[model samples]
Structures are given as structure tokens and as C-alpha cells.
Target: MERKKFLRNIVLVSLAPAVWLAACKDTGKPAAQAGEQATYTCPMHPQIVQHKPGTCPICGMDLVPFDKNNKDHSLTLDNSQIALANITTMTIGAGDLAGFKQLNGRLATDPEKTTVISSRVPGRVEALYVKETGVSIKKGQALYRIYSEQLASLQQEYLLAVAQVRQFPDDARFAQIEKGARQKLSLYDQSDTDIQRLVQSQKVDPYVTYPAPQGGVVAELSVTEGQYVTEGGAIMRLEGYHQLWVEADLYPAEAVKPGQTVKVIVAGWEQEPQQMTVQFINPALQSGSQLMQLRGTIPNPENRWQPGQQANILLPVKSKNDVLTLPVDAVIRDGKGTHVWIEKSKGKFEPRIVATGMENYDAVEITDGLSAGDKVVVTGAYLLYSEYILKKGADPLAAAAGHQH
Candidate 1:
């Protein structure tokens, strides 16, 4: 019993020291260490950073904490982190708003507005009133003069027939000759003006003048002074300068309805862009491209908007009553789906899957995945994703490599 008591005393003594050492190991070191300062940097310019958080001077952007766990975080020799970074952000919120299906394309002409100029009678041109394309013309304005042997002979026969008709008032030969002469002259564009003038003057007049039917700019000028033009031959192409079209290529699922109002951003123009609507949509997709054509009609009063000009089209879709939207660069696209990083606080970000809808170059519609008040890591989403990849034992390269959703 004394030996057992002695062994118990020894064990108690040993446990007392161990208990004290274990308590000592848990001193406030960890809690004090956890209060370390966080490092922050701008997403747009990674070179920018500060211990005291602030914005970038080059561009106004809020600084976010640099986290190693971010899937977008990458090692670099500059002692600086390289990762997916953006300076832009927006909120997905509930409100009355217009949704859009955006597309990029070039300015084009409205086929309906283009007018082809042709002649009714075949002849060789003697003189061209308009010398070059782009010249404005007016209705009833003389565009050119043509001399045709057929017209000259027809005029001579009409003059003779008119004189013969007047010489015998009741003779059937006179009436028949006059009727044939009038029909021949009419076929050559001898209008009532020309026919009446010939009858009154009792003279044969040859060379004919053709007038423009409508006023517009001469888009194409095929006639030199002496070009022989057949009847119905193309003489010039005239297009109204007051209105035009903007055409954009669209994917199969893009919503584009005729008469739907759309906003247009004209590239390389300083003037305020015009608002218009869809004029038409090609039923068949373009061969080899598999892209459908969407068109919008815009007024060209100042001639500022020309056909073939490059443009970014913002087509209004449905009105997303109350939802969240963010800058397109704010979300990181993963193989499974699109994800965003929600900033919990300093040095903490959580990965979140987001449901997306209509996405334009400027912003994205957050359909079912986000709320109006949730602050997300729009600038450093890729950085946060890096952490998720690490925890899942997944390849960061695979995530970083892009796949369009």
C-alpha cells in the first residue's frame, strides 16, 4: 500500500508539471499575432498598394486586401501578386429597369431607302449635269441629256404627221397617222409637254433631257458624258441622306424584334449617340457565320452617321423588375458555372455561384443568384477563386484558362 501511494504521488507530480506546461503553451501569442495589419492593393494596377487602405491615384478604384487563398492569386518575382483584377463594379438590385441583349457590329445602309436611277429609253449620253457621286440632286432636275437616232426619227415623223393631220380635218388617213405618231413619241418619253410643244411649233426637235424623279445624294455614277445606256440600264444610285441603318450580327438566341427600341453607341464619334429601334431582322442566318443580322434605323440628318461605320448596339430586352447586375468583369467563369466572391470583411472572401442572364460589354444581369444588398468582390473575384481551387485540390490553371459561359 505504501509503494502504491508513492507511485500515485509520483504520477500526480508528473501530471502537474505537464498541465502547467500545456497552459503556458496557450499564452496570448496567437491572439496577438492575429491582430496583424492587412495588405491592400488596387485590382486595375497591381503595382499599387498601401498598408493604410486607399484608392488608386491613376484611376479611382478602391483597394482590396490581397489574399493568398484566392484562386486567381499568382506568384510573381516582383514580390507582388498577379491575379485576375478589375477596378469596375455594380450592384444587382431590384427596381424598374430595362434589360438588354447587346451586340457589336458595323453601320450599314437600309436597302429600302436606297433608290436606283435608270432610264426608260436607250440612248447615248451627251452631257452629264452632275459630275461626281455624293452630289445632291432635286426632283425634276435635269440630270443628263441623251441623243438617240430613234428619238430623232420619231420626232421628224411626228412633225410630218401633225402637219398632215391639220391639213385634212376629217380624213381617216390623217387621224390614223396622228395616232401612230403620238404612240411612237410616247414610247420614247415624249411627254405631253414634248408632244404639245411639237404640235404647236410644227417643228422636229431631237435630243431629250431626263429629269430625276426624287432628290438625294448620288451614291453611284455610272454615266460619263458619252456612255451608251440601254433602256432600264442602271445610271446612278441615289440614297436619301436623312435616314440610314445600323446592322449587327447576333447569335441564334439573341432577342431582336422589329420596332424594339435600342440604344446605339457609335464608335469614334464624339457626338451624343442616337436612340433608335429595330427596323428588320434577316430570317436566314448568314452562311458560314451562323449569325443572324439585326438592324436599326437612325436618322442621318447631319450626315454624321454613315453606312459601314462601326458601332456597339444595346438592344433592350425584357425589363428585369428587381434584380442584381454587376460589371461583366466582376464574375469569374468556372467550368461548372459563373462565380463571384463575396467580401465578408478584411482578409476574408467567400466564393458564390451566380445565375446570369443578358450580359453586355458594360454589365451583366444577375438573375437568380444574388441580392440587392449583398456586397460582392467584383474587383478581385479571380483572387478569391484561387483559394477555393486550393482547398478543393483543383488545378488553378484549368480554372484560369477561359471557357465562355
Candidate 2:
């Protein structure tokens, strides 16, 4: 019986160790279950991990299933790295925004201030007092001389009429003849002084001098010394430089109102930008180009503005009172499409494809891919884009970046 007890005790010793090992294994089951209880993490801030689904504490981004397969759109940067990259962000919201439309234009002479010098009667150009274009002349200055047989015949008729009037002063027929002769000379652009002189001297002059009608610089001279010209034929073009016009083309979508002030920047002129008031806008569409014409006048009393110089015109486009806007710097452009970097959480950003509309110098209209109160990376968007490219070796927004149209 004692031998049987010893064998039984050895068996009990073996069974006790097995029971203790089983107890130790059972104690580890809860820890293993806890470790595998559906882990979650931030897609943007991958360092944020949790045992269950919840919002990230640092960025308020929703925690997604921790899957190693989908890491392309997600990026995580430490505090030090973010500081070194100089990253910044802004919360977009609905507000009043102003848009602008930029256009190209050219400086030109004011048409109202231009004068066309033409011949009043058919004659050959005898002599030109103004030699070339750009010659400045004053009002009443002799511009050219014309020698005409018609002028000479009128002069001789006046001389004979004056003789008849002096010989038969009491006859009304002689007075009528003298009046007819004076009328013929006046029709040929003969000045009153010249006519009176001819009557006093009883002489006939073949050539008559034409005086400049206005004071300005010659812009175009088409006549030579011996050219024959007809009545109303343009001889030259004179334009005043004290005032100028800035003209530009407008598309059908653009709206312009008279008296609205716009700013103009001359390409090569270093002076401060000039404010030009809207002088005129064509009511009908331009026939050939189908574009509308816009005009603005600028004072140039100093003769500083030159015609045909390039200019940049800025037209203020009206904006809605309440609309979400993103800074222009926040947007990214690639062959794929227009996009922006959205801060899903602090120190985390993801590429978001967006549709855009009207734009201005500083901001752009956000039509899609975001909502009000969404955080956007405005300042360091380019840096984030570069980081995404380097990390993924491909564009994060390639699939959705292509032109949607």
C-alpha cells in the first residue's frame, strides 16, 4: 500500500505543474485580446493610435482602421519637423469676398483731342512749313502754302470789281459784282485779312498760305511739297499730348459701368499707378472680334504718357456677400488637376481635389471638396505637396487630379 501511495504522489506532482502552466496561459488571454481589439489610427497623423475608434486628440481627425495597405493619402510629421518646415494653416469660412479681373491694354491718344488737317479746296502743295512728324506748332502758325489758278482768278476778279466799284460808286450793279467776287475768295479758305489786302493793293497772289487750326504735335504727315490734293483730303494728323486714353478689350462675361474708376499700371513707366475713370464703353459688340470696347481717360498735362505703350488694367469684379474663399497660395496645380492640402489634424495634411470658380489677386473661390470651418494649409501647402510626393513616389491626387470636364 505504501508503494502505491508513492506512485500516486509522483503522478499528482506531474499533474500539479500542468495545471499551474495552464493557469499561467489562461492569465495571458485577456492581454492578447486587449492587444487585438480592433486597433485604430489617424490616416493623416499615423502616430496617433488607439485601442478603439475615436477622434485624434491632437488634430480632431477621425480614427480609421489601421491598415498598412492604404498609406498613400496619409502623412504624419513630428512637432520638430513641422516647425522646421514653417507650416501654417487657416480655417476657411463664409464671408464677403471681392474678386478681380485683370486685363491687358494699351495707351493711346484721346480721339476727341485729335485734329485732322485737310485741304479746303483742290490745290497742289507748294511748301510745307512743318517738315516731319512730331513737329510741334502753335495755333495760327503757317502749315503749308498752296498755289492754285482758281485762287489767282478770284483775286483778279476782286481787283476788277473794286475798280468798277470806284469808277461807278452810285451804280448798284458794281456793288453786287464786288460782293460776288469776295464770296468766291472766302469759299477757297482765303482769310479776311488777305481779301482786304488784295482789295487795297489791287494785286493778285497765286499762292495762299494755310495756317494751323490748333496747337499740337504732328502725328502723321501724308502730303509732300508737290502733291496734288482734293478738297477735304487729309494732309496731316495733329494730336494733343496733354491728355491720353487707355483702351482695352472686354469679354461678354465682363461687366463695366461708366464713371467706375480703375487702376492702370504702365509697363515701363516707374511712376505711381494712375487711377483712370471710365469714360466710355461700347454699347454694341465689336463686329470682328465680338468683344466689347472699354475706354478710360488719363490726364497727362506733363506729356509723360506715350501712345502704344503696354499697360495692365485691373477691373474689380463684384463678389457675393457670403462665400467660402481660400487663399491663392493654398491651392496646388499639376497635370492632374487643382487641389489643396487639407489639415486633417494638427501636423497632418492630405491632398484634396477641389473645383474652383472666380478668383482674385489674393484668394480663389472654392466650389467643392471642402466645407466651412475646414482647416486648410495656406502657407506651407507647397512644402506639404513636396513631402507627399517624396514619401509616395507618386502624386497623392493623381487619380482625381485630372480635368473633370
Candidate 3:
């Protein structure tokens, strides 16, 4: 009996630890579950947060698990999200803002390079060598053929005068008459070569062919085949593409004047920018517009560029040196005002409202809310702004305003 009693005591003592271990595990489960409690938030409408997985009532987007403890205005993105958003940062410091004022402009035909071709005599068009507009013509190229009774009579008179001059070489009266006839033919658009050909062929050809006086691209064809043209009437219009005019609009406040050299970047060929001098700035505003006209000339020696092409002019503005500046895209502007996303820590970003001064095409002046050596989100700032709104259910600028207050 004594041995049995001792064995029972040992068994009870051993069982006591097992019973306590079981109770401890049972009580710890609920506490662990409470610590692990998760909340869900809509990516698009973070205001719709719930303790369970469901769709957002406002935006109807699927709710995603979010850290409820993240109450600050700053946002944190993982490596994958950062890479997916293409977020990039740059350290800003005091430096010269080497920026350009971009002005929209277009290429145009230089009026000084345009020419109008006209007929020297009334005639009936027999044929056209260049039949259509936009045809390229070279010097001495046959332009058209014309048939006229007047031309035929002039050729006959020229032939008679040449024959008389050959027969009566000593007679001054015949020589004078020959010279007058030759001059008349010359006045009627007859070249020396045409007169020599007529004298050689000894034929009264009623149809005469005319040659182009210069090389150009035919811009307009006023006369067609079988169309009669009168003396001094327009036959065709030609334009030289050796140079083009670049015209842009400038506001009254822009400090641009004639003789200023500016950079011109042709659309689709931005790699090769040309330097052009500002030739004219209209003293008065354009009709029905508040902007003034800015004109410049660009050389197109290869004729590769066409008129009416979109172009951009880069005008240099007075740069502010030793100033805080950031990429133009780094700043965000909305109804909440202007702010920039700054790196508070690795993978963490916060919005800061900043006062701006002068700005240019590539950079903006940061007058307040930032200091030198601050890392700024230069790319994908809008993505961060969006993510902040998605995760925080508020505008990043709103937080900035709150801090300011």
C-alpha cells in the first residue's frame, strides 16, 4: 500500500506540468489571433476600410490588406512596387538652373525665297513639260510649249532680217533694221539660243518652248495644257527650299527681341537642332490674339525639312544661379496647390508644399520647404502621389497643409 501511494504521487506530479502547458497554449491562441488581426483597404478609395475582405462601397474595388498602424502622411513602397512604378530620385542642391523656355512654332516657306513665273507674251499653251504642282524644276528645263501667230510672225521677221544682214553687210540701214528685229524677238522671251536655232534651221516653227529661269519646286501651276495665257500673266509659282522661316508666338512679357540667337528643334528630328537668329518681332499684337509674332530663319540646305512642320524654339532665359531647382516633373500642381514628393527614408516618401519662383521648360525653382542635400523624387512622383491617396484616403497636399497650419 505504501509503494502504490508513492507511485500515484509521482504520476500526479508529472501530469501537473502537462495540464498547465495545455491551458497556456489554449489562452495564447486568442491573444496571438488578436495581435494578427488584419484590416482591408480599397486601393482606389482608402477611406473604405473594413476588418474583413470585401469590395469598397465607393469605388467598387477589391479591398487589399494594409497596415492599420501606418497613420502618418508618409507612404512606404516595396522593392517590387518601386520598380514597377519606375520611381527615381535625385539629390538636389544649389546650382545654376540651365533651363530653356520652350515656344511652339512651325516651319513656313520663306517669302523672300518664293518666285512667280509669268508669260512674256500672249499665247495658247500647246503642252506643259511640268504637268503638276510640286514638281522639281531645274534651270534650263523645258517648262511649257506655246503656239501663237504673233510668235510665228516674229520668227519670220527675225529670219528675214538675218538674211538681209548677210546679203547687205555694208548697208547700215539693213543692219539697223536687223538689229531692231532681233531686239523685238528678244523682248518676246526669245533666248539667243532660240534665235540661233531658228537661223540655223531656217524654219518658221509656230510652237515655241520656254525654259525655267531658275531651279525650284513648283508650288502652284496657274496655267495648264491648252490654256491661253496673256502677257505678264502668272504661269507658275516656284519656291526655294534652301531655307525656311520658323515663326512662333511670344507673350508680351517674354524678353525676346530681334537678333537674338535661339535654338530650333524640328519635330521628329530633335537630335539635330539648328541655331537661328530672331529676325523680326512684331511690335503689335497679332490680330485677335494676345501673343506677338516671333520670326526666325533656318537653313535647309538639303531640303530635307518641309514647310508647315511642327517645331520648337528653345529660348534662353536669365538663369538663377545658386538656387534650389528640381526637374519640372518633380513638382505636382493641383487644386490642393503645388507640392513635391521627397524621400524621408528608404522606400518612404512624404509630400512637402513648396513656394516656387522662376520656372523653365526643364526645371522649376524651389524657394521653400526644401533644402540642399534633399533627395527628391524626380520621376514617378505622380505615382507616389496616387499611392499616398490610395493607401491613406487623403491628399498628400492636405497633410502638407496640416503641417503648415
TM-score of each: 0.55, 0.54, 0.70
lDDT of 3 by residue, 1-405 (tens): 999999999999999999999999999999999978888877766567778888988878888786666668788888899999999999989988766889999999998988898887788989888889888989889898888788889899989988998998999999999999999889988888888999999998878788888889999999889999887889899899999999999899999989999999999887788999999999999899899999989899789999999999999867778999998899999865999998889999889999898887567899998999999999999999878866665667888888767
Clashes of 3: 0
Among these predictions, the greatest lDDT belongs to 3
Q: What does the lDDT read for residue 391 in candidate 1?
A: 42
TM-score attained by model 2: 0.54
Per-residue lDDT, model 1, residue 362, is 59
- Evaluated against the true structure, the overall lDDT of model 3 is 0.88
For candidate 1, the TM-score is: 0.55
| Ten residues in sequence with the least summed lDDT for candidate 3 | 41-50
lDDT of 1 by residue, 1-405 (tens): 999999999999989988988777787567655656566666655556666678878789886676533444232211123233442234455554566656887777777767887876778888889889988888899988887877778888888877787888789988898899899889877899889998788766668898988888889988788999898888888887677778889887876688887788888762466688887899998988889998877787777777888887877666655556787778777455677765544344445667888665556778865778776766756654544443423433343233222
Candidate closer to the true structure by TM-score (higher is better), 2 or 3 = 3
Q: Could you report the Cα RMSD, in angstroms, for every candidate shown?
A: 12.3, 13.2, 6.6
Positional deviation of 129 in candidate 1, in angstroms?
Answer: 1.6
Off by over 4 Å in 2: 1-99, 287-290, 318-405
lDDT of 2 at 307: 89
